[model samples]
Target: MDIFTGLINGFDIALSGTNILFCFLGAVIGTAIGVLPGLGPAATIALLLPITYIIGSPVTAVIMMAGIFYGAMYGGSTTSILLNLPGEAASVVTCIDGYQMAKKGRAGAALGIAAIGSFVAGTVAVLGLTFFAPPLAEFALDFGPPEYFALTTLGLLLAVALSGGSIVKGLIVLVSGLLFAMVGLDPISGKIRFTFGSIGLQGGFDFVTMAMGVFGLGEILYNLESAMKTEIVTTKLGKVFPTLKDWSDSKWPIIRGSVIGFFIGIIPGGGAVISSLASYAIERKYSRHPEEFGNGAIQGVAGPESANNAASSSSFIPLLTLGIPGNAAIAMIFAALMIQGITPGPFLVAEHPDVFWGVIASMYIGNVMLLILNLPMVGLWVQMLRVPYGILAPVIVLFTTVGVYSTQNQVFDVYSMLFFAALGYGMRKLDFDPAPLPLAFVLGPLLERSLRQSLLISGGDLTIFVTRPISGTLIAVLVLLIVGQTVFFLKGRARA
Candidate 1:
């Protein structure tokens, strides 16, 4: 299992006709949604997960899905530049200088630099994945159930802190999700907990249906309540290639952003949005001409775009190596692997080498496809905005409903999905973040299993969680996060 040999085998699978085709399809679909405002990659992936089972192989399904993740990162800049609209949270910073450049008739150049920077960052991230994932997984081989419980507990806490709302509210949502996960039969004991005498509840809630409901249908429903209007900035066609001056100005920012983003993405709750923001802030701090940032600085566009893409790629590390997804997109990926009957963890690289490596290799190919798609196809993506939301929302709902129903071929699953959709919409209207809920649901069973196993191994001693080195360190980190968040919450309330 040398890195080179692993990569070659990965490329062997990735370069296959079927994988390449799916990869290309994913890139195209990811870019399409990225250009269309309001439908982020997480929702798109959740919406698509049901169809993944039909793809026949886990490797191809995951490769296509991974392509969508990073491809959206590459394509999100298109709308940011042309319409001053961010397709996802990570692209928000791009709207600053990117829209300014568009106004100054440098839209094509801005888009070009973004594509180049994304490609470079994404390639670097893939290389990092190749080298870093195996060792991390190997290190994790020594972990026991106590360590797992600690890690998952820490992950849940991090999700609440980063979920972007009242910490109390996030906790409530997290708890609700955990309760929802309790609907099925107990993992350890065969007896059911909360089914309440429903036959469909016996099998528990379908994760795919719930995901589609909460993320896909719920998002669409929430967006429909808002009055969204787009005014596209149409300018004269210009050269799609960046000039030497543009390259000189952007080269260092791209590299710095990539490095910053990769490390940030490794942390729990760290993601493309935060990484891009950090990159923009750092680039501004170090820039010789700091005042040019909000105006039309290429660094503003280059840094954040590169950082977000890099973060998106490296964020896969936690999921692949540790079985913990850092954010909702990666959570969807985790769910996909679970649906494929493949658990991602320390042994993932050893047990499912094809999946682990094929995904990495597909990223390299996907980045190239994105670069090739971004330039000549920019106009095509721009036209996508012209589609009215009035017509679009129903289509999305119809697809989500069909996808959910297709999972069990039962009307009850569809009803369950709509129920969660309503719940998600209600939460959104109340300013409660639903992001943590699905993630919490996905991790709840594993967390419970780990806790039970740890307790049994320790013979009912609670001290085992804090007694082990790895588990102790994780618990310490979790305590610190809770204390910090409590202080922050109190301070905010005092100020308010």
Candidate 2:
């Protein structure tokens, strides 16, 4: 009952005119980026972070950013279905069946299922957030430095565990990300480690610049190198609304995906991407026509789309409740929240119920807004597929350059972005995954800070890490994962 009352009050606050306008703006911008290839939510949010300073209210800024994050999730599928391009990693699964469905003239069905599934998942996940976030925040408040370190270690290991191929390559990329993160100022000594004597290097790599170079410019370069092109197949405007039969097929996948994705997302790792892939794998295994996978399987689109949205919603649990961002997008939101003089944690819910619950309530509203926005606009998004890369490539580069330059108003950052763009292109050509690198970059500084803090608290005694049950258990699990992977690889090599 208290939760119900709180949620109602949140609705009142979120629906206010100013906040509502920001929500609309965020959705519109996010959808625009999602429909376009290359640019993603992380880059968009990072580019917009500086603008939050002008907005002057942390709650409003964070709310708007949240709207963009989820809105991009809604929008990313549009390109996947219409152009065979995934605007974001979470939408990659959408391309397998989504693009195929388009080729088979089932574009309407794929788009409809994606939007409906996302709507259902986003709504349910918000309910999960409203109820679960406060309690988790409370639990996190009790964590010490050692516990935090252990949790981060588990997260990194899970990242390695979930890496699709070549654990060695994943670890290498993860280490590279950590090294790149270390290029900034030293957290403890305030000493510069990798500045290379350049004043510009003092600030280290900007997240926005790195993401834009790797995702946006890198994608453009890759597409340019390939002669392959995307054609928008004519889609018969069948029922935009999903049928009962569609519901029957998708119901269990949605529920299962929501449950699976929500929990994975709360774990403070690559939860969104992991959940999407996991949902697709599960749906494929349980599907009546498993062979239909990668060939416009409705279950393929339904399960992953739901899982990704649910994961996106649940990833907020850690950020809003514990001030620990699970990913880059959430990290940007954290920066926005901090600028508002609000420290997100268990006490935040009690201290600022309006902020917390208002954001929660707005998610519900945002989901509805996205569904309404996506349905009537399906034809328009499909039209976007027709945009020629010859024209689009230069526009992407322009946005990338402008967005990176806007971060610090420095030409140096733009140069760094172009450098990363070339690096990203090289890595993609080498079959290296860029995903793990960003996770490592994001987590590296936190890992260093936590380690140092734990040492200080324990008087430099490493035993403190193992003395705590939860932390110790997590460390042990990481070790087991590492060893398990090694053993599996050895066996495979021996068999070969």
Candidate 3:
């Protein structure tokens, strides 16, 4: 089969000594970060983004970062099971039952199921990427500015729709993210909007800084406030492998999660998080003992863990094929690609088959590595929780400081990170979701660029957006989603 040959070529690239070493290093470091509380893959990648500059080739840099992405997804579940703390957003559902399982002396089985499910999901998702990416890229080539604009709009609407709780709040956060993205230079006129005369402000706030602030520092601050009274679950080393019953119960959830995650991941914005949450919700809704949820259900750990990893893999499709990043981690990869003078788009598959297929192959290798590393080393990961907070806190702060500064070797980034940290902490206190902010910021520039280009091509005619069938259909779906949310909200209020 042609697909088989391409996979062989991919393996040839991934198995090379140089790539293998980097892949292993990425997995090791990613797992380390995943075991630690308060740090997520986005922050870890942001911290390492500067390393790509020294590493040279964008292909290698991206491959390594991709390792970190999936590796962390694999590692985060360890923390969720052992400590009741999720190292990343996607692992939150894992904590619902993973920690409880630990308390009930099934930590090993919970962790094993997570590892196995992630492996299956990740492998299938990469295969999907390998066979489907080129054709998707070809299709995207037919898109015009209007289509892109419509697509971005649809992405934003989807993000809002999936935001859960208070659609108004979700929209507000989404708009705020869009506004934050507008702080930099105007692409059309080369004029600044929100810089306000500060030289540092002219370049705009880095999304990395904002993400670290919101997810990392804010998490630390919240935990610190309650650290004194928090109960830590202790795990008993039981069977390190899943039982026949565990396998039977989890097989369907793993399959369902992978399918759901892959499709959601291709949808442009907040797909990974949404897929994970949706998978967990689905698993719970369909489980025979729904009441056992949040009290050590193995399906909870298996389903969301599978979804998160699958979603991480599928998120790459948009980035590699269309130059559109589906999430923050993918956006950072885009920046690395641009830094290497490599353009990602329709021609990427033909222009750089090695980079394209090689990365895909590396994922397969990385997934296997993660499964091996996560299972046998469960005890080592659990030991990480025993590390003293006083010692760990400073290390995290140091990494955050260095990573932000490394972005452009500017101390201002450090201050910007601190400022956002405070802002993030406040937002958390107010129950304001920060998810939409990064999504909006990343998509804002592209949205503006496409809108202007579409208008230019249409001589100021707005009908250009509706003329394209795909674009029109996407717009209609967005409108329907907004109306549906509104109706649901009004109905709920009326009942109350």
Best by TM-score: 1
The estimated TM-scores of all candidates read: 0.97, 0.87, 0.90
Candidate of highest lDDT:
1
Task: Quickly count the clashes in candidate 3.
Answer: 0
Tens-digit per-residue lDDT, 229-277, candidate 3: 2234456868879999999989999999999988888777656678889
Q: What lDDT tens digits, residue by residue, belong to model 2 across residues 1-496?
A: 3788889998998899988888888887777777776666876776676677678876678778998998888888888887777877789989999888778777778889889988889888998999998778778778877887887777766766675666777778779888999997897899998988999888788766776676667767876887545666455656667678878888888888888788877776656778889999999998889999998787888888899899899989877776666776776676567657787766778888888888999899889989988888877766765677788788767766876677678899889988888877887788876666666776678788989999998889998889898788878887888888889889999999
Off by over 4 Å in 2: 1-6, 82-87, 95-106, 227-229, 288-297, 335-355
Residue pairs with backbone overlap in model 2: none
Report, for every candidate in turn, its global Cα lDDT versus the true structure: 0.89, 0.80, 0.81
| Model 3 global lDDT (CA atoms, 0 to 1) | 0.81
Between prediction 2 and prediction 3, the one with superior TM-score is 3
Question: Candidate 1: where are CA atoms >4 Å away?
Answer: 227-229, 494-496
Q: Comparing 1 and 2 by TM-score, which wins?
A: 1
lDDT of 1 by residue, 382-424 (tens): 8888888898889888888888888878999999999989987
The list of candidate 3 runs beyond 4 A from truth reads 1-6, 206-224, 228-233, 270-272, 284-297
Models sorted by lDDT, best on top: 1, 3, 2
